[model samples]
Target: MCVWILIGLCIITKVHGYSDGDFPQSCDSLLPEHRRSGVNILPQNTKPPYKVTYKPGNNGEPITVSLESNPGHKFSGFMLEARETQRVDEGPPVGRFISLQPDTRLLTCSLSADSAVSNRYSAGKTLIRVNWTAEGAELDITFRATFVESYAKFWERVDRKVTIQTTTPPPTTQPSTAEPSTAKPSTANPSTVKPSTAKPSTAELSTTNSSPVTTSISSSTTQNTQRPDALGLKREGTVQMSLDILFVGVKMELPNIITITITNSLFSRGLIKVSNILCSLLSMAVEISAPILFCANDSCTVTLIALMCVVIVINFMDLVIVSLPIGPSHELKDICDLAAKVCSVIHMVFTIAALFVAVLEIDDCRNNRKDFWLLKVMTAFTVWICLFLIWTFVVSIHRNEILGRNKTGSSKWREQGKKNKLSAAEVIVTAVSVILIMGTLSFTVTVIAGIFLAKQTCA
Candidate 1:
């Protein structure tokens, strides 16, 4: 902290105010040429509190320009000048201020003397009145100013566009459609300048113009990858997907819940130690991989959120293993198992559908191919899910065949005709069937919804 204070003080010592109307460096941007870090151009706030009050002047007539701020707002310094309306963004202000207040003086720009008018002292003042004489050559002209509330704060490009009528008026062939003589930069944006101070939302206290966070509204959107102009853009949907990883814990797999209940329920389960562990590991790895996109940036929140989600899923899986009953007499468990499996089907169907929509939404751009590896990942996961359905069915059939052939060695309860529990094959079949049906429905709903949203957005 002490070191930082010293650094700030050292920089401050060299940062003298541009008091003597010596800010020709700000000719283009209209911002004070401090060029130090931590200052920036913010977006418009509310309506501008300053206004321009003027009357149309004919050729050779000296025009009065009044610059006033709203009550309670005083600017310590300002630079005011007029430019041709056609070159508003680029033209230079030249010798327009013929008479100026003693507190304000004329600025000799790079090419022209008395090219602009500015406050001569760094004292807070509310109003500046000056006389501008048109040098016989006349067209439309506008008055713009950069007002400094203080050395450290100011608003640039506060302008009011008005038509200064030339002395020898041309034939008024058509009715003047020009707006009222009064002009404010833009009614839509106050000051028509970056304002609201927004000192708080400072592009991470931006020494530059960009202030968007990792998952900001701008970064989360997926843009057209096919545009050659987007070659340098971040991978498509990467930011949005990273944000989605935080929900993995809440989206715990349904099959894992059933697997935990099988050995302790009416379902006579087979060994699932291998496949069960592999499935959970695979899914968790996929969720974890999502954070790799964030590695390029310094946003630790993405990594932390992803890890937190992973922890939640692991805890839920553990809870399922620890809580279920150890016998086949869980009548409630039977009903719950069936219902949960049905819900699982519905969930997977939606999952599959969502994955498909994700694939469809991928930006088809050659340059973004490497960044868009997420699409390939979605396809691989889909294939694996389909394989899980087929593998479970095939294993269950094989298990049933083996069990039927060994009927002679069946449990005493089965031998005595008291068998009522569901077999491994039955359990597996129910789980697989529920998944297939629900997954299909999920896909259909996703595609239809995507289509509807696309139409709405395009329209």
Candidate 2:
């Protein structure tokens, strides 16, 4: 136990500690001083996986600068700096960080103290905000950051421009100078106030009831001047949303995609729904449909049997048709191999147990015993557990397939996953998956609803 504790401590320290002490050593170039072996990595040429946003700030006041990464995209280290927009390329870091978030620290990238900000440790981060004080005439500046996902993956020069909102002293609320009520009669004759030389415009010249035309024209002008062209705004919003989705897909780290996909597919939805359905759906029968047997319902036994049967068939087909030769246990030769072995054995046990329960369930429903409730509960949980393992098994196979590629870069995977057309097998499997999920969900809901209505009474 002591040894294990020590090892755990070591891992935490290694992962969270900042070995390269905070300094402006590489502030000029913003390149991480990493090992020469270098993993052949380069700055991402694609849409950045990060976003930099800031509310407008008055000069001399601290602006809350926020750096946020998209869902599932996290970084381990980062350096943030601001530069005068006009001299962005040549200028030193401009703003001073007055305050900072935890896990971040100020750096003297320029001669000034706290001229830049950076991560204090190497731990993963999804979002960070810092209070940077904008000073001087260079209120219009650009923010740039270098995000390090890992030693091998980082993007430098992620940039955003902001013009600090400054208060112009409210335009010096001027005193209104009242004009004389009567203009001293101009020192000229009354005849001198002749008709103006300027000719009337075409509409003004038409004195014969032109008010309607003037009103219509003025209304149209007003409509055009007002904000929010509905169609234009909608179109812009839709395009931005589309691009955001596309960029999100393209920016995913390839190394994490398999694990993230498997986890989300299995637990995020499947596990939650499966457990909830099984635990609650059976109660309907107990409350109403059971006629006394929420525990006695035959659906649990039947569903369990069907699920186990499907799993068994899937295992057999995978071995014979999909994996072939030595089966998936040897074919994939990764975590999938272990999953193949474990899932098959667990499902086999479940099938036998389910069949055994089904017999007792039928007999009990006929004779009406308290043990019937126990049997129903057992069946529900068993089926749920089996589904969990089944999803794991499914995900492992898919994960192995995705990770088995001989590729090196994330870009290649993004291009392939995005631009590639679906194959016939892929299309078919996708359709089957959709159908299966819908059918099972519907089945769960129906079982729950069944409890609401008592068994049909004989007329």
Candidate 3:
């Protein structure tokens, strides 16, 4: 037991010694030489002339200066001196350095601990130079002096008031004069004048001459006074007339004339005559077809009766041209030629139908409830048919790849067989085509509905 107890004590002592050795004590300290080394330390609280105070002056104000240190540092003793160099010595003199011995027990120093030393520096006109040595450090440091303008001078200039005087000219004075004497009549004039001629009296002659002169002067003055105002009125009238013409033209072009008129009145400021003429032509076109063509009870009836008879005749002529045979070819080439003919016919039919509808809609028949619904449906069908035609075009261009053929068909019978086999790949193609068609159809229908709703609301 004595041996075990002795071994345990020895182990405990060794552990404690190791722990104590690992623990930290004092921080790293700088030597006196290191502290005394000169460094370019920037002043914390000293923005040079170190301090500033302003008092009134004849032109402006004078600024005063004080020198001080940053907080947490002692003032120690300081030298006030200008910077000296080999070429120039233009700074203040060196003075006895004052010591700032801070007493920890003093309340003033304690309160001032948080305040900057510059706050205690007196404000005066003298330029301040500062050199400070820290309490324990032997090296000397210096800062150049400067002066800052006061806020009062800045504000005074910014808010300065000015006065101006204007003199009025004195009223003019009119001269008073006596009336002129009347002239004596010439004695020989009445007798010497021809006996057959009648002699006019002086009063009559004077009145006749004066009347024309007075009238001419009055007319000239009136024209001069009214010319500017008359010109202004004429300009205004011309502008208004132009605006009226523009409005008329727009009404002619658009189907919804009333809505257009209201919109123009609300948004447009002036008239444009060219716009009016164009709109009028468009309106006439729309009005002509509305009742007879677009709103007709039967498509065949409108097709026969409408002015687009010329277009119909041309399309018929094209059909005839396509049907006529030009040359013989292989089976695949024959099928391609046949497809081209069918595509051309389809395109012609679609174009004729579109033109017919457009002409009828322009005439104003689009406003009819039945006609409008028919048109909407026709438009939707047309869009779908266009998509189908595009797909057909793509399939035609890549017929071999789509039909899983290694090369083009050599004969008409082989071409027919390949086209027939297309039905076999329908499941995949149809699914993708349907998805694309449905997405496009939904988007188109939504847009058309929105347009219709906006038109209705605007109307």
Candidate 4:
């Protein structure tokens, strides 16, 4: 009895002792039978960044993975790493990884059996963390090997996945007339389609134009890609005339019209100035790349990467300055910082555009297969821009709230409470900035990989 009890205790301890290292670390380490799988990790708190659904190979069916944002938090996007498990004695390693941000919550990925993804190793234990700076809230979900497989199957049965389908109505057929036609229709095919005689939708005819616009929206859609021209340029004169009439009528409201015109002029001028600054900065990046432009193909590639790093540094500085806590009475400093933040955002946008151009201008890239490194950088930048937009909103909201509350002349304790909340908001901003910097650094590494590849070719 004593021996049996000791053995039972040993078994229990072994079962509970499984650690992160025990899990498959790469796609290659995953069981051959379990290829194309997902492991769901439930969030520790509410508002998880994303919910994952892994559908392991279903009888001979392709493996599938689905992701959705949890309630109270929207899914922004994700970066996935798929590494090939290295043998203990292997000389070197190679693998594939990709980042994607599908807008929909019900994003699905189908992994084919023949795809190389099956050969890549799993990312070992994974974590999904979501931070909502506005609400000063965060949630973390960790996936462990011991529970992933079981949880995935469990969620499959509990969560029903639904797909939406849209159907277009069938075209109406004209009824055959009993009376004989006076003249038979031409046998030759018409070069152009006859315009529909039906009146346009009220929405389509309601477009306005007198506001310094380039074109009038005279159709239901702004543009129809399915059409031959793809611009929806075949608008009827009647529709155009209706829009003109409405726009002219608006202009007749003299005071409102004058105010709108002034606003438009100011906005347009501000946009022009911003654009000019961005263009100049981009030109400077190109000039920096010029010294090594012709030394070697590899040198040119390096130059492009260096330019990207410079922009990243500039943006990082801007982020740091913007993140500095504003004193309670520092309104001027706050306004200036806000303006600087806007300019920094525009600078980053132009910088990203410049990097794209630099990549495209690469001689090797033109002929060689597209590099995943560049794609990763692009994805990172796209995600950063989205986050920046949200961060701006959060900052604006917190600033307004704090200022509004301070105006109320609250008690000392209440003021302190507001200050605490403001501090939390600042912490969130700093955290987001750090995240952006980390992402940018990762992207830089990816760019370096391409540069190294170019160097290899030159060798």
The prediction achieving the highest lDDT against the true structure is 1
lDDT per residue as tens, model 3, 1-459: 999999999998876332111111100100011111454222224332222221111111111112433343223211222112221123222212221211000011112221111111212222222112122322222322222223111000011111111222122111111112112123435544432122334434546545645654564455345433323322222222222222222222222222222334323312322333344343234333433333332212233234334433433443344344443334454564444335333533443354334323222211233444434544564565466556645755675565454443233434566433324443344454555445444543443453344234222
RMSD to the native, candidate 4?
Answer: 26.7
Per-residue C-alpha lDDT of model 4 across residues 1-459, encoded as one tens digit per residue: 999999999998876332222222332322222223454343232223445453322112222334444455432223222112232122111221111110111111123211111111122223231110111111121111111222222121112132211222222121123112311322233432222212122213333212212232222122222221211121111122122212211211222222222335446434434443443344344433432332222113343445445654654454454445554357666575556556455545545554454443332222233443554555565576566556554655574453233443233434556433334433444455555545555555555555445434322
Query: What is the clash count of model 4?
Result: 9
* Best of the two (1, 3) by lDDT: 1
lDDT of model 3, residue 126: 28
Compared with the true structure, the alpha-carbon lDDT of candidate 4 equals 0.33
Q: Give residue 153's lDDT in candidate 2 (0 to 100).
A: 74
Off by more than 4 A, model 2: 1-20, 36-40, 165-169, 172-459
Q: Which 10-residue window in model 3 sums to the lowest lDDT?
A: 153-162
TM-score for all predictions?
0.32, 0.34, 0.22, 0.28
Residue-pair clashes per candidate? 14, 4, 19, 9
Q: What is the TM-score of candidate 1?
A: 0.32
- Per-residue lDDT over 275-343 for candidate 2, one digit per residue giving the tens place of the 0 to 100 score: 323422232222122121212321232343354455445344324321323322354645444543454
Query: Cα deviation of 250 in candidate 1 (Å)?
Result: 94
Candidate 3: lDDT of 109? Answer: 16
Error of 2 at 27 (Å): 0.5
Each prediction's Cα RMSD? 23.7, 25.2, 37.5, 26.7
Backbone clash pairs for candidate 4 read 26-121, 26-122, 27-120, 27-121, 27-122, 28-120, 28-121, 38-54, 83-121
Ranked by TM-score, the better of candidates 2 and 3 is 2
Q: Report the C-alpha displacement of residue 431, candidate 3, in angstroms.
A: 10
On the 0 to 100 scale, the lDDT of residue 42 in model 4 is 39
